[model samples]
Target: MAHIVILGAGIGGMPMAYEMRALARAEDKITVISNNPKFHFVPSNPWVAVDWRKRDDIEIEIAPVLAKKKIDFIGVGAKRLHPEKNQVELDDGRTVDYDYLVIATGPKLAFDEIEGLGPKGHTQSICHVDHAVEAEKGWQDFVKNPGHVVVGAVQGASCYGPAYEYAMIMDTDLRKRKIRDKVPMTFVTAEPYIGHLGLGGVGDSKGLLESVMRDRHIKWICNAKTTKVEAGKMYVTEHNEDGTPKKEHVLDFKFSMMLPAFKGIDAVFGIEGLTNPRGFILIDPQQRNPKFKNIYAVGVCVAIPPVEATPVPTGAPKTGYMIESMVTATAHNIRDELDGKQPSTKATWNAVCLADFGDTGACFVALPQIPPRNVNWFSQGKWVHLAKIAFEKYFMRKMKAGTSEPLFEKMVMNALGIMKLKDK
Candidate 1:
């Protein structure tokens, strides 16, 4: 009887548990370990910050849902990852042994890299639901006395989409409140250009996003290094293509939201041969650590290098579809190992993103997330925004239903000619 232990119950881990169950034997025990009891839709965090969504609207208690599928649950977070023994030390003074372990704990926000940079500091964040809620409070107080606003990703930040989303969402929200004119907005990012998005400008994204920002009247600073953030003031240096400082600015703002750089969670950090210097799990194409065959990883926890170098360093994004593909591939490979076969499945690493801009948005499809891709497309419209809303509802329902590959999702993706895995 094999016991499969999955750490983290977020977007990648939950579906991975369900998919493992679908592919595993009846006697194989499957368990999910998470720090939080509830599952929150991370994509809707920007809306929460703007008070367009309440906590309950985007979050659901996941224990009951996982229980319905006969999967054991542990809310106590992982204290240590003993890959050598194939056991996980839980925070509640317990250890769980596993025949196969999947780590999907996601990224640890690296806010300490810069002074006065995070929720506890001078700015607000929407990375977590709780942080977004706090940002909502900050938003409320700021709108009362509108001034300049700064929103973007800092140096070494990987998740650029949300920064873009929040900036546009706040703009849209302020316009609705009829006070947009009172507030000037500036976008500061680590990417060399407006739409590098860590995938090397997906289908003229540079041009499209620049045009969109111009239309929206939001100024921007790219290749920006945030030296420090003080109360109501941000010190920034914009770098030239040759990696030289070209411009410097000290911007003042009544409200700010800057996405922090990401590093691996502490549980697996410094694990020799198991992780990269940044502490992200080191996985081969099969999604299995080369040195630790029994261990696998998915989602933001995996190490993927930057597609190309930039003036200011940036990393590739592990998009929702790409992470889902990794989850599916890992589950299949674990099943293969159990059946006494060499692991073969590999995640496609495709990128499908729908970035909301309040009432309108941009959508992109990168066949392969790296450069020299086959199919790279980017488009924008209100329908994309509606699609994002539909996706949020659909995904929440999927988690509740414990359905990894829902029929409706397949149909929609098929209709759009999107492929999660490459054709064999």
Candidate 2:
């Protein structure tokens, strides 16, 4: 029996397991190793930070879930990967051998790079369930005495959606508490513009987001580079369009949240040719490693070039829907390879997202993955918010059941107008 070893149990890893099951033979065995026993819905993490949701409500035990599907599970952390030897070294000094390996170890937070920020001094983040839980506690303390609020991403950070999401959620929460007037809010990011979103502005995104933020009275600073963060204050310098220098100022905050830069998980980074200079995996168009035929990567773990050279420093975020597409494509290729068939190359990923603003939400859709052919559209309404909630429920339920249908996938793709078919 051929054994398949999968590392990490996040959005990218788990799906590959189910997809591989669909492709592999009865004699083949599937095993999953994750640092945590539970999987947390990362998108809902913003809600958890604002007390809108609880830890239990957003997470599930991965061991039970995977066991129900008959996949062997190892709830342990991966220490390193030996692609040449085809073995995964566990931190416990144990090893797991595999015929095929899927490296879905998602990005790790680089909080140490930034000074006086993160879990150490002040500033909150919605990066993980634990972080969100701790941030929620901080929010409770802030509500007792309303003060300054700053929400955005740090330089070189991808995953920008949550930063905007957190800002609006905080705005809404304060308004709900009738303390909006007590808090001075600001939106800061490394994106060059109000709506770049790492993929550049999707159709009407610039107008829609800019207009909405103005209406919400949320001050913003784009193309801004953060230097250091002191207690209750942050130092930042803005970059003019030409990458020239600009003066700096001290922005103080009583409560703040900033997304941290991400690096490849330590386990996979040790292997040669598996990652880029910044510590993210290097995968070809098919999301397969060029150096190791049996190894593949997807999700935030995969490396992509910076969208542009900005003095402030920034990188494109591979959104959730895009990551899902990568996993789906890899699953198909791996199954084909196991059957002694040639694998199809990975398809390019586009973006489909909903920006929930608490009272309402905004929708965005972009195509082609990269630039040259980009159309981003944004609209504000209560329905968008309701739609996002419905989608979240649908995803959790579907994941719990362990199946996502092809028909449903087609329907979603067509609805988003993201994928262009060759015509039936």
Candidate 3:
């Protein structure tokens, strides 16, 4: 029986394991490796940071859940990947062999690329539950002594939705606490314009997001390159469209949470023919590595070029719907290989996202994540906030049940009238 090993147990990995299990031959073996023993819903991290959701509410013990599905669980994590030998070295000095490997370990937050960034330094983060927990402590202290707030993603960062979500959520929280008047918030981003979202501004996203920020009294600086962060101060260099430095600004803040750039994890970093210069796994349209045919990738760890270049560099985002497509495609391709057929399935790479602002939220849909799509839609309402919360609960339930159903395709896309959009 062929053995398939999946690295990571996050948003992409967990679903991959379940889907693989459902599709693989009963005699085939499936194993999931993760550094963290528990799986936390990453999208809820912003809520966690603001005390809207607690850690326990989102985190699920991984081992038991995988056990119910009859999949082996390894929490020791991966130290290195020896693709040539088809083996993975574990952190605890063990090794696991696999007939096929799926790298879904997600991105390694590149906070050190900038001076005094990240939780270890002057700023806070919500990339992980642990980071969110720590940020919550800072949030508590900040509410008591409100001051200037800095929130946005840095250069080369791929994920932009969370940065926007947190900014709006924090605004909502402050308003609820009746302390918003005391906080001056600024959004600093590498995108050429507001709501570029690393996909070249979806469906009037630029105008809509800018209007929302204005209404919320949040100021913004685009094409911003964050150079350094010191205690209570952040250094930024705004850039012109020609990539020339335009202005230098020194902003002071009591609380800051800047999304850092992401790169491939250490286990697969610098692996020849497997990753790009930034360490993201290089995958063909089928989600299979071109050089290493037996290896595939999904999620944020997969390499995707920027939709368009701006003054400051930014990477394209692999949103939840896009990643789900990748996972489904990867599973089908692997199954096809096992059946002695050439891989044929391809992920649509569509982009659908819900950005919650606590009380109200926005939803956007791109037929394909890249620009020049058939359908580009964006809308906002209180219903989106409710939908996002429902999505969270439904996703968490799906994980616990170990179901391999495609949540995005079956629910989100359908609800958004994707069928009608596609017919256009």
Cα lDDT, all candidates:
0.91, 0.80, 0.93
Write one digit per residue (lDDT tens) for candidate 2, span 1-424: 7888878888777777777776678888999999998888888899899988899987778877777778888999998888889999998999999988888878889887878768675678889999999999999999998888888988888778888888888999998999998998888888888877877777778888888888878999888877788878998777788877566757999999999889888787656788887778888887888899888887888888876676667888777677778877887887788778888867558777777778798777666656665544455678667867777777677667776443224424644553233111
lDDT by residue (1-424, candidate 3, tens digit) is 9999999999999999999999999999999999999999999999999999999999999999999999999998899999999999999999999999999999999999999999999999999999999999999999999999999999999899999999999999999999999999999999999999999888989999999999999999999999999999999999999999999999999999999999999999999999999999999989999999999999999988899878999989988888889999999999999999999999999888989998998888888777689888887878779988998999999999999999877656554774366457
C-alpha lDDT of candidate 1 relative to the true structure: 0.91
lDDT-better candidate, 1 vs 3:
3
User: What ranges in model 3 sit over 4 Å off?
Assistant: 418-424
Ranked candidates (TM-score, high to low):
3, 1, 2
Q: Give lDDT: candidate 3, residue 313.
A: 98
Expressed as tens digits, the lDDT of each residue in 146-263 for candidate 1 is 9999999999999999999999999999999999999999999999999999889888899999999998899999999999999999999999999899999999999999999999
Poorest stretch of ten by lDDT in candidate 1: 415-424
Q: Stretches of candidate 1 above 4 Å error? A: 406-424
Candidate 3, position 155, lDDT: 96
TM-scores for all candidates: the values are 0.97, 0.95, 0.98
The local distance difference test score of model 2 is 0.80
What does the lDDT read for residue 270 in candidate 3? 99
